[model samples]
Target: MAKIFSSSLGGSLFKDERFLYQEFVPERLPFRDEEISELVFCLKPASEGKRPTNVFVFGKPGTGKTVSLKFVLSELEEFSDRAKCLYINCFEYSSKQSIISKITNFLGYAVPSRGISYAELFSKFVAVLRTKKVLPVIVFDEAEQLLKSEETKSLLYDLARLPEQQKLSIGLAFISNDNFFLSQIDDRIRSSLQCSSIPFESYSPSELKEILRERAKYAFNEFALDEDVVPLCAAHAAKLGGDARIAIDVLLKAGRLASREGAKKVLVKHVRASFTQEKPVKVEVTSNLSEQERSILDLLKKKKSQDSGAIYDTLKDKFAERTLRAALAELEEKKLIVSEKEIKGRGFTRIVKLAGS
Candidate 1:
C-alpha cells in the first residue's frame, strides 16, 4: 500500500506566518514615529488621571493609524494604572447598544447580550465607570461604520458628552480612511468632540520597502526571499495604491507559492504569479465598505448607471435619502464609483456609474 504522506519534505519558507497577519502588532512600527509621538501627546493626559484630548486620525488604509494607536494604547495602559484602554472595530460593533455592551464587558461586567435596552446598558456602563473612577481610553477603528444612521450617530454624541453629562473623564480616538467623516455628524456633536486631527500619508515605494523588509525578517526564514522579491512586491503595491497591507499580502502569497512548489526561496516569478492569485486592491477596499456602500455598488453593477433620483427611489425602501446620499458620496470618494453632471429635461442631474465602467 502507498504511504498516506510522503516522507520527504522541502524546506519551509515561513518562520512565523502570524507576523504577516493584520492583527499582529510588531514591536516597532516602521515609518510612523511622528504619528506615534502625536498619539502619545494626545493621550498622555489620561495617564495623569485627566481627560485626554479626543483625537481624529485619518489616513489611507495601511498607513499605520490603527496599529500606531494600538501600540500607544498598550504603552499607556502599561505605564499607568489610571488609564484603561479598550479597542473596538466599529465595523463589528456598528450599533450603539453593541458598543456600550462591549465597554461594559471590558470594565469587568458581564452583561447579557440580549434583554437589555440601550438606555439601561448605557446607564450601567456609566455607573461602572463612575464607581471604578478609571480613565477609559476607547479607540474606534473604521469609524465610518458608525455614521450609517442617525441612531448610531447618537452613540457618538453620547460618548462625546460623557464628561459633561456623566462627569467621567474618558478619552476617545477615532480612526478612519475618510477625511470627511466629521462633516456628516451633527454640529453639536462635532463641537462636543473637539478632537485633535492627525493625518497619515500614503507610503511611498521606498517607505513600503522598509516596512516589507521589517515584516519579512520575522515572517520568513533566512535566504527565503530572493534579492528582488521585496522590491517587486513594494513596487507593485505602490503602483496599486501605496498600501502596505497589500504589499505584505503579496509577500505572504509569494512565500506560500514557493513553498507549494518546494522551492527554497521566493523569487520574482513567485511574486508575479501571486499577483493573479491575490485579490485586487479594489476587492480589498470593497470588502471593507459598509453594507450601504456595498448595496449601492451592487446596484450600480446591475444598472451600469443611474440618476440620483432613480437610485434613491430604488433604494428608498431600505435606506433614507440622507443615508443614500452619504453612501454615494463615500463611494465616489473611494473611487469605487463615478459621478458626472448630466443635463436633464429641465435641469442637470448627477449620473452615477461604477468606476472604469
Candidate 2:
C-alpha cells in the first residue's frame, strides 16, 4: 500500500470551533447575564449542602436555557465539591427507568443496559448520594414530555420526598419550550416541587446579530464572510424564531456553499441559498405520513385506483402483503383515501381511491 498521511482540514472557511455547535458551553454566555445571575442565585443554596428550590425554566428553542444552566454548574463544580450536576434531555430519554439510569451513569455508577429495574437503579442512586454527601443537581431539558408521561407522578413524588425521607439533597431544574407547560403540571407535583419559574424570550434580530458576531470571530477566518453575510444569516434565522444555533448553522452552510464554488468570500446570495436551496421544504399532502404510507400513495398516484389485491401485488416484493394492507388502513384512517367494498366473485374486494377522487 502507498504511504498514508494525515492533513489539516485546510482551505476551509470554518475554524473547527465550539461556538458553532449547539452543545458547546462557552466560558461566559453573552446576552444572558441577567438570567445567569438568577439561576446562580437559585442554585446557590445547593452549594452549602442545603436543598435549593426546584426550578422550571421555560423558553423557545435555542433560547440558551441549556447553555446558561450548564454555565452556572461549571462554576459550581470548579469551586466546590458539594454539588454534582447532571443534565438530561427528556425528549431523548423520557421513560422513568431511562432517566434514572442516566442519573446513575452520570454519577460514576455504570448500570447494565438491560435486565435492571428502575427501583433498583434509583435505590442504588440514593445510596451512592447518601454515601458521598454531595447534592445531585439534575437538569431535565425538554421537561414537558416527562410531565406528560405516565411515570410523572410516581417519579416526581419519590424524588421530592427523597430528601426528607432519607436526608439526601437532590435539586431539579426543568427546561421546557412550551410557555404553559408549568400550568399544565398537576397541582400536587407543583406544590411538592415548589419550583422557581423563569421564562426565556426569543432573541431579537439585534440581539441575534450580536451573538452571531461574537461567534463569527471565533468560527471563521478574518476575511472569509462579508459584513452583509452575518446580518442576512441572522435575519433569516430570526424569522425562523431567533434560534442562535440556527443562525450559526446558516452561516456555516452559506460559507461552505461559497467554498464549494471556490468563492473567496461568503455573500448574501450564499446566505439565501443556505436558507432555501440547501434544505428546501417538502410541500406534500402526505407530509406527516410514514415512508410506507407515502410509498403507497406514490403507487396509487401512478396507478390511479386499484383494488387492495392489485395494490398489494405491485408492492408485495417490497414488503409483506400484510404490511401493504396495514399501510392502506392507515391511509384510510388518515383520510388520505377512501375504500369501498364490492363483490368480485366468491369474495368481497375493497377498491381504494385517493381522497380527492
Candidate 3:
C-alpha cells in the first residue's frame, strides 16, 4: 500500500487496466461495429440447437478479429445456455494429441496426457458433446500454426465430418492473419469447412487516434497523461500496420516508464523510449525447459556436435530414451539446438548440436 502511494506518478494511471490486455474484450469496440455484428450472426444458430455455419476470420496481426469474436461469444453465453464456446491457440497447442487433449479437457473429460490414441480421445470428445445435447463452438486462433503437419489436416477433416459421423451440433471458427491461409490448407479440409469469411481492414491514422483516445480515457488519469502522448503512440502504431494493440501496448509501456522514473505524468519521451524496449520472447522460457533439455544444451555447449546415440549414452543414467527424444524435439522446436538425420546402410544416425555452436 505504501509503495502504491509513494510514487509521484500517483497510485495508478489506469482505471481498468485490463482493457489494454490482448485478451481483454471491451463491452463496446470502437470502429468494429460491422465485424462484431457479422460474428454475432455467425454464432446465432448455436442458440437454437443447430450447428452454426463455421467462420474463417483472417486479417493482419493486431486487427480486431480475435477480440471481436470473443466479445460475440461472451454475449452469446450471457443469454443462452444451450451453447458453449471454446478457444484454442494453435501455436501453443500444435500437436494432434495436445489439441485433442485440450478439447476433451474443455469438455470436462480427463485422459492421460500421452498414450491416448487419437481415435479413442476423439471418440470421447464426440460422446461428451452428444450426451450434453449442447452446441459446441470452437475458435481456433492462429489456425495457420497447425498447417505445418498432415495431422492438422486430419484434425480438421474429422471435425468437419463430425456432424455426419455423430449427428452432433458443433461449430468451428478459424482465425488467421495470413491472407494466403486458405490456399495453403488441404483442399478437402477447405471444402469441408466452407466457412463464412470476413476480412478486417487495417486501421487508418484517424481511426487509430479515436481508438487511442477512447482507451486512454479509461486507462490513465485524466491529467496524468500529456496531451501529445496519445497521438504519438497512435502515429507510431499506425505506421506499423495500424495495430491497435501496438498503440495500447505503447501507452501501457509509457505509463510504466513514467512511474519508474518517478515522473508525475506520462509523456512523448516515455512513448518513444517504450518502443525500443524489446518484448520478451514467448516461445521458450528457461523455466519451461525440462531437466533433460537443459542438460542436453549444456552438454552440447561443452562437447559440441555429437551423434544422438552418443548423446543418449552420456545421459542414459538420468533420462530414458522417450524423455531424451521428447526433450530433443522441444529443444529443436525452440531452435536452441539442431538435429540432422543421416542415412546409414540400413538405418539413420541422428546428429545433434547447439545451433551455431
Best by the TM-score measure: 1
TM-score, per-candidate, Cα-based: 0.80, 0.75, 0.75
- Model 3, 236-322: lDDT tens digits are 777665778888898988888887886778889999889777334423365689899999988998889888888889999999987
Model 2 agreement with the true structure over 1-357: per-residue lDDT tens digits: 543422323456766555677787877667998888889888988898789878889876778898888888889877679888888888788788888888888888888989988889889888777777678899988777776766865787778778677877889998877666777777776777788988887888898898888888888888888889988888876765577877888888787788777677888888888777533332444677777788788988888888989988887788788678767766764446656678999999988887544
Which residue runs of candidate 1 sit more than 4 Å off their true CA positions? 1-10, 279-357
lDDT of each: 0.88, 0.79, 0.80
Best-first order by lDDT = 1, 3, 2
Tens digits of lDDT, candidate 1, 1-357: 876456333457889878999888898998899989999999999998999999999977778888899899999999999999999999899899999999999988898989999999999998888888678999999998898888889899989999889878889999998877887678999999999999998899999999999999999999999999999999987765577887998898888788878897899999999887854767888889987898888898999989998989999899999899889877865767766678999999989988656
Number of backbone collisions per candidate:
0, 0, 0
Determine which window of 10 residues in candidate 2 has minimal summed lDDT: 2-11
Candidate 1 local lDDT, residue 219: 93
Clashing pairs in 1: none
CA lDDT for candidate 1: 0.88
Q: What is the TM-score (0 to 1) of candidate 1?
A: 0.80
Compare the candidates by lDDT and give the number of the best one.
1
